[model samples]
Target chain A: MKWEYESPRKAYGETLVELGKEREDIVVLDADLSTSTKTAMFGKKFPERFFNLGLQEQNMMGIAAGLARSGKTVFTSSFAVFATGRAYDQVRQSIAYPRLNVKIVATHGGVTVGEDGASHQMIEDIGLMCGLPNFRVIVPVDSNEVRRVIRFVAYEYGPFYVRLTRPSLPNITSKDDEFIFGRGAVLKDGDDITLIATGIEVSYALLAAERLEKDGISAAVVNMSTIKPIDKDLIIKYARKTGAIVTAEDHNIYNGLGSRVAEVLVENYPVRMLRVGMPDKFGRSGKWNELLKYYEMDDAGIYNAAKKLLEVKK
Target chain B: MSDISPEKIRELKLIANKIRELTIKMVYAAQSGHPGGSLSAAEIFAVLYFHEMNVDPKNPEWEERDRFVLSKGHASPAYYAALALRGFFSEEELVSFRKLSSRLQGHPSLMVPGVDMCTGSLGQGLSAAIGMALAAKLDGKSYKVYALLGDGEIEEGNIWEAAMTAATRKLDNLIAIVDRNKIQLDDFTDKMVILDPLEEKWNAFGWRVLSINGHDVVQIIRALEVAKEVDGRPTVIIAHTVKGKGVSYMENTAKYHGKPPQDEEEYNKALKEIEEERREI
Candidate 1:
């Protein structure tokens, strides 16, 4: 089926402008990446409540904490590397320790950030943010889900980390779909094996499951958007139903959906699993699609991993 | 400066001495802490809590209350003493400092009643203060934001980033006070990382800079009062002080930078010196 593509950050920018209209206390801060992160949309509409902290990621996190403490639900934007990697200490001490009402909406996560190369790509952000307490992590599947995220966090108090991709993705999620925090949605149920994914990889996993059906294998696709307080119940439910599992993500295999699902199953229902993600290595200058394919994260990759895991079951 | 009455200075002096004495006792009771910095910042805490800031300890989260952040959070002994004196919490909790399950962690935590932000890691508080200042401007509220940073703590590059942001936004309602006691963890900051011409540095960053004797209650008050008048940009008060202001044995001694009195004789001598100063006031 043909699908329309939309940028998640673009949806984020539009939704934020709409939220700014209703909430008098919503403030946005950006660290010189507003243009790329699309937070410039909110800044242009609400200049008084917007702050461009100018390349100072560490200071921006600290400032975000202060704004939240003053009873304003603050949204901060920067690249994945700069927002989480550059200011880990600031985020830990200023935001996470006290659990302030600040949302960190970082754009350009994973190797899909393209010709900017490994320097701009941040596959470790999921692991970095998940390690912190009092933080709810989410990697929205599509533009519509991003819209739901913007509204959910605006009214919800406490710290949050929302990761968005650089490339625009197909709308695998529907507009009428409701987003429940810390819950996963089962797109397709299968009795043979389950495919768990997040971010832009959700679309890739869905396509992979479609192809798997032709090979006499039943594959279930799940969009595990909330990565920190992961849907343990849903994961365990599928683990009990399907004897084999395959986890896919745009991050490193060590700490992404793969590691989380493995941890959940190893404790509950042990199963044969293969993680489809970037191997623990760096990427060079290449087109985003080519880089993803070269790393074997496309439908071919998921299908191959699913076949191999099922073979191990035999 | 002359308009400020002598009686007011006397009362602030007494409070400063009490803060110094209380800081020594907290560190002594806990048997571990950064006493030198706490003693050095006693007068700054005294003036802010007693005379300068418009804060009601009973209503700490009052929307209109002036906000304060102890950016140099290792000086919690002085901070807790000032907050206790201002009637935020019971003075009896002072002995419970650094105990397990106590609100007072080794560094400042928001779990405490009057702490506005949690800041133990250096060079992060000024930005938090600026955030509060910016929020006040967004809401059109009149409350000012104050943050106290240690000279050593300012060595972290995050301080300069916050400095640029404050002036870039032209936050006149924000005031950052540097407890310039000249000592850091290892030795004097002058010997480690030179922050000299610190006044020119602030002026270059577009801040109105004020220099004063940090130990003098009158100077501390005058600088804070004058900082409120600064408009179009933030104000930074560089209050110069001794490593340990009240106690004789600990003064200028790097060993006491993060240590309490070792024996009963040293603890008694430290308390006696602070008590004598209070009596003189």
Candidate 2:
């Protein structure tokens, strides 16, 4: 399935409004970025349920924690940079430690928030959020998958961190497919190498598998969307069958999907692997596509990494 | 306001003395708890727990019961002492201060029946208190919310943001008490960062201000009574206090802000002084 036109953040906002109508307990809190984060649509319809907390992200997190303590399901929205980085302690202590049912809806993830510069991009958010206990970290591949996640996180009992993107991307999953937590989607299968990816990198991995196949290299593409409670069973099964793995993501290599995949394979099925992500450096201000290519987060980078891993396996 | 008899004031003072003694015992036993702020906050906690607030210890979660948040969580000794004395928990629980897996943690948590919010991070509790007050208003319940803020912790930006929200919402059911002991962790709040003209600031922020001698049994009770009368605006009871009020060596000292009482000799001496004061009462 392919999206006609829609960003993952927009999909999240629309789905939230639908959930708001179904549940009276659902409330949306924005730190003066409702329009940019795409939560303004939900705010417009569910005006009473929406809270514009001005530019105070730290206080907004505290307010959401308070509301959650009072038995309200809260979704706090802001740029991932500020939401996770600036208010990290408040989220850690108030929301995450208490295990509140607060959904941390962060938009403008990774280098996708182009032209606004490195300060706006949040390549380290997943790493930061996943380190906290009792947090479910999710990064949807596209708008369709994000719709599924919006419903899943809203009804979930504990704290959640949903990393959404600012730009539009092609939808990769069909509506009828069942989206399970901690389960990986096997988009395409092959025999030689397993390409495990998460978030926006999932689509790139799919495209890279296609390119690899033309050169007689069969590749298996697995979308490891849920990062924290990662689908280790799938990664191991695919690694045993394929014998080599390539992990890719639009995040840092230190604590993101790459690190998670390596941890699983090293413990279970020891296999040759290659990790592709930011090379431990700050992102620069540029067009999103140009930055992706510069940071080696493109299909070509995945294909090249897979080729190198194949060499080690042989 | 109903007049509190002098005998009742003496009785409340005895209760406050007992709380201070228990607080000292807990910190001395734990060997790693704050004593200064806990001592300074003792009288205020005594008044709130014994007289000002409408709370049933047997039913800690009673819907209409008043809520209190200890924003300055380092002063948990005083809060735990008050709760234990008020029958929220067993007195034996105080012995397990800062111990692993104990309900009496270094900070107040909702796991304890009487605690309204899990607060340790400064400048965040007022917002939680405001939320509780908002919930009470929405539910048409007349329950009040009280939050104790440290004079030093007021420098945090989130506290001001919450102050703005509370006044804008006209949370008259919410009352904030600033434990104005004037000392922070390392130095005097005035030396570290001046929060002088604090009364004017709260007044400018739309909160009705009440100044009182925090340790005066009569004045704390009077301030709280006046706070309840003001409708349509949040009330701030600025209670001026000596950092370590009861102990002679520790009085007005920032060094005692987070330090526990020393050896058995010093502990016995402090206990003797408190006992002598009680005997005079």
lDDT: which candidate is best?
1
How well does candidate 2 reproduce the true complex, by DockQ?
0.61
Model 2 scores a TM of 0.96
True C-alpha contacts between chains kept, each model in order: 0.88, 0.43
lDDT of 1 at B143: 95
- For each of the candidates, give the backbone clash count: 0, 0
lDDT of 1 by residue, A54-130 (tens): 98999999999999999999999999999999999999999999999999999999999999999998999999999
Best by TM-score, which number? 1
TM-score per candidate: 0.98, 0.96
Error of 2 at A284 (Å): 1.6
Name the regions of candidate 1 deviating beyond 4 angstroms.
none
DockQ of each: 0.90, 0.61
Model 1: pairs clashing at backbone N, Cα or C within 3 Å: none
Candidate 2: how many backbone clashes?
A: 0
Clashing pairs in 2: none
